[model samples]
Target: MTLDLQQRANRRMRRAVITLGVLVLVLVAALVVIALRGGDAPPKGAPAPQPSTTAPKPTATLPPDDGGYVAPAETVKLPDGATKSGDLPVKFPRTPDGAAAMAVASARNAWSLDPQRIRAGILAYASAQYRDQMAASADAGAKGNREFAGIPATGPVPAGATLNAWPIGVKYAAVDSDTVDVLVLLRVTHAAKTGTQPTTTLIVSPGRAVWEGGDWKGTATDPNQPLPDPVDIGTVGFNEDRWQAIQEGDRL
Candidate 1:
């Protein structure tokens, strides 16, 4: 009976050892598969990896920083045969192309309050260079007084006076180029109880001028329309209202 029991025990031990060996082999195979999938498997003949979501982005190109957004206007070069005068080359629309350029020019001109007509008048007449003389004359003219106290026509207008009317009765007049006009109007433009300072002036005066060429030469400019020469500023011209206002109290 003892011999039989020992044999049975030995058989059982052998079976148990074999089962443990089989389980160990299975575990080793599973670990190998996991390692291969992690990084060691033969890349499956796949393409190289693309950038992932967490990868850094490429740098973007940006425009150069300048004081102004507009690229500096480039000077145009003219063709050899396009010379206008001396070494200067003339290159531009030989002919006006329909209304595009004209339309743009007109729009820009209209945006300005002053017109070329009034500008022409200033060039042909008022000497802005002589500010003091004009101011003194203006004072005398408005007060119906004269700076050359002896000469009733040459006096300074009193301090506190305004010229508040359109010197020229007509709103619009056709003036040819290169002419000067002296306008006379009655306006009260200051804070005086005397009828001299009307709430608003009702002035009717004359503009003396000659039409020469296509330019109206002598109009006047106020703080708004002032200029070295009116013709130089706007191609269209100065507005009559502002010019007249500048020479306010001085109108006869």
Candidate 2:
């Protein structure tokens, strides 16, 4: 009877262990199902997550620069026999070639028959060194200056003579890091002449320009040099108002 009781006790212990294992497996399966379904949602009355309240940082912006020159203020007398006041100085092309064009155009404007305009051009356009040289040459009664071209010691231009200089082409050579040599082909005409058909002079002017005051200042180092005969590139009407504008130091 004691042996039979020991067998029955062992059987009861085994059944208890199996029942515990089955309960543990059922609990693990329930947990896995809940995990796969993504846990429970928040209570229905809870507020939604608040958006960030801090302001966004502003992006940086730079001031605008056209890379061109701005003309200073001046008072100029217009060609219409009216004295006009200039509100702002003219702006020229900011590039090297553009600067060369302005230099030549201003030089051409200096050839006006008006004495005052001639003086103004010298003051407005020429380099400080060139200006001093021109003054010294004039005081010495020199014929002409290499830097100032056909401007005479006595007068800048002849009486009743007006010369219009237009550049046909421009070629630039780097003389050094700071200097440039420009070969400009120009057609010069005297529209004020009494002749029915005005003769024009096609010339090649070699100018040496140095960077000064944020712009290229050109001087006619070799004004007498003539190029090979050039073909007629046609002509345009001479506008006095445009001449006046250039005289007033406008960048064209």
Candidate 3:
């Protein structure tokens, strides 16, 4: 009877161990199926968006320049052979009488000029804005300056040194840009010796210009001369020769 009881206890223990092993095997199989299903499924179309790589920016532009004063149409070779541009130059009318009268009028309008000072230098200097032209006229006075600031002397004009008269020699010439030329015979005066009155001589050159305000004017500078000053928009037509042309006493 004791031997039978021991055999029955051993059988019961073996059955419990087998049940535990089967439960553990079922749990492991279920976990493996779940993992295989997840791995085998097709991937979704939408993915997390990534950051973008940016490109470089473009360059900036500069502003346009408005010429207040009449300037050269483009760059020009200077007397020194160097080139420069962007400046306001005086414009001259292309007529003999206009050229002759310009200097006289400028002299007459020279503010507070010593009425008796004769305006020798003023008359010559104010003819046009060209340093070259003015220097050319130095011989019209008492000075021996062959040149002023490196400009050679150009002598003998169409008119006299003193343009104190009217209906002087006049001629017209044409240039680019509807520009007309005026060649005027100026009458310049020199101090007389031996109690003689101022002597006179003729000066003729083309007065450069456009037909504005009932007259043609000259470019303050020679054609293509480099400008030391910048073009001013506020004074587009306000040039030295233009100013001299329309002065109070200059209504020709």
List lDDT for all candidates, in order.
0.21, 0.33, 0.25
TM-score of each: 0.21, 0.42, 0.25
> Residue 157 in model 1: shift from native, Å?
10
Candidate 3 lDDT by residue in tens digits, 107-133 = 222211122122332322232333243
Q: How accurate is candidate 1 locally (lDDT)?
A: 0.21
Per-residue lDDT, model 1, residue 47, is: 12
Q: Is candidate 2 or candidate 3 better by TM-score?
A: 2
Scored against the true structure, residue 229 in model 1 reaches a CA lDDT of 15
* Strongest candidate by TM-score: 2
Q: Please write out the lDDT profile of model 1 over residues 37-113, one tens digit for every residue.
A: 23333322111111000111101111123433322121112112122322212221322211111111111111111
Task: Report each candidate's C-alpha RMSD, comma-separated, in the order given.
Answer: 44.5, 42.2, 46.3
Question: Ten consecutive residues with minimal summed lDDT in candidate 3?
Answer: 50-59
Better of 2 and 3 by lDDT: 2
Model 2 score (lDDT)? 0.33
The ten-residue window of minimal lDDT in model 1 covers 50-59
Model 2 steric clash pairs: 71-89
- In TM-score terms, candidate 3 sits at 0.25
